[model samples]
Target: MIIDESLPGKEECVGSLKNILDALYVLNGKWKLALILCLVQSSKRFNEIQNEITGISSKILAKELKDLELNDFIKRNVYPTTPVSIIYEATEYALTLKNVIGELSAWGEQHREKVKQSMRKQS
Candidate 1:
């Protein structure tokens, strides 16, 4: 089959698609980004993170924390103490997502406003 020389090559398209897939594989799901955003703001204990994010169960939070730690996005520090305090903090690597998170936050706000306007118009 002949190919269009003006268009992007198959290899280029595949590479881009692979990159997107890799990103989604790491960052997909409702709670991962939110959890990262929370830790980026401040290191917190498990209960504190759950309280800040709201509605995330203990089980899910534990899993997400482990996932982020494995991905090198967060550092889980365990202090040697009677209660064994553990604080979760965003790592420098996780800071790489700051711009992405900011843009997503802006888009979310704009989308919410747009939907509200559409609903009001319909009413």
Candidate 2:
């Protein structure tokens, strides 16, 4: 890959670096970023996403959608049918997160275990 000089050098890429930090900025938050990634795999109905995410109120979901749309991470399409259906899909930029999402999930899994171990030790 043609590395950009403005970007971090290969030697500085070790440890908890900014490449991942930049990703977390977009994918951070309890339900906001996760919702975007979940929708990215395929177009999903609003209710479907809500049901899977759990504990996300319709209002919050609506707000998250607006934020993601504003950031160009997601796109919302509404059909003018009798019942008016809405679907959310990830944009090209957001679609670049397949590997990122995997890395985060793995990191989170390890972090969760470390926390559990600490709690056990403290107890």
Candidate 3:
């Protein structure tokens, strides 16, 4: 999907391809979509996210959160209270993704079922 100079008068098509790549740049990870779903459930602190998203290393979670924040998909609120505290919540932009994520999850489930049926038939 690399855009090249040969595609003359195709700036519009190139733009569309660029847009899709930008999207995949953010949501192109095993953990990112799941992390978004978890955040959709409720606003949470760093430790809370790490706990709820079992097996996620602190470093990886931090990277994912940073990526989401950069993508304008989540907001990080810092409280200047005791010991300093922060909470991450889905932004309005992120909220818009709820329906999309739901549909994707359903599709994944159905795909899994189909795969299982195929496996069973082969066995």
Candidate 3 weakest lDDT stretch, 10 residues: 1-10
Clashing residue pairs in candidate 3 (N, C-alpha, C atoms within 3 angstroms): none
Sort the predicted structures by TM-score, highest score first.
1, 3, 2
Writing each residue's lDDT as its tens digit, candidate 2 over 1-123 gives: 657658666768764477768656765678876887788768898889888888999999888888888888898898999899888988998877678678878888979978798889999
Highest lDDT, which number?
1
List candidate 2 segments past 4 Å from native: 1-25, 116-123
Question: What is the Cα root-mean-square deviation between model 2 and the actual structure?
Answer: 6.5
Task: Give the C-alpha lDDT of model 2.
Answer: 0.81
Off by over 4 Å in 1: 1-9, 113-123
Instruction: Give all candidates' CA lDDT scores.
Output: 0.93, 0.81, 0.88
Question: Which number leads on TM-score?
Answer: 1
Q: Candidate 1 residues 1-123, lDDT tens each?
A: 657657778999999999989988999888999999999999999999988988899999999999999999999999999989999999999999999899999998979988798989999
TM-score of each: 0.82, 0.70, 0.74
Angstrom error of the Cα, residue 91, model 1: value is 0.2
Candidate 2 or 1, higher TM-score? 1
TM-score of 1: 0.82
The clash numbers for all candidates, in the given order, read 0, 0, 0
lDDT of candidate 3?
0.88
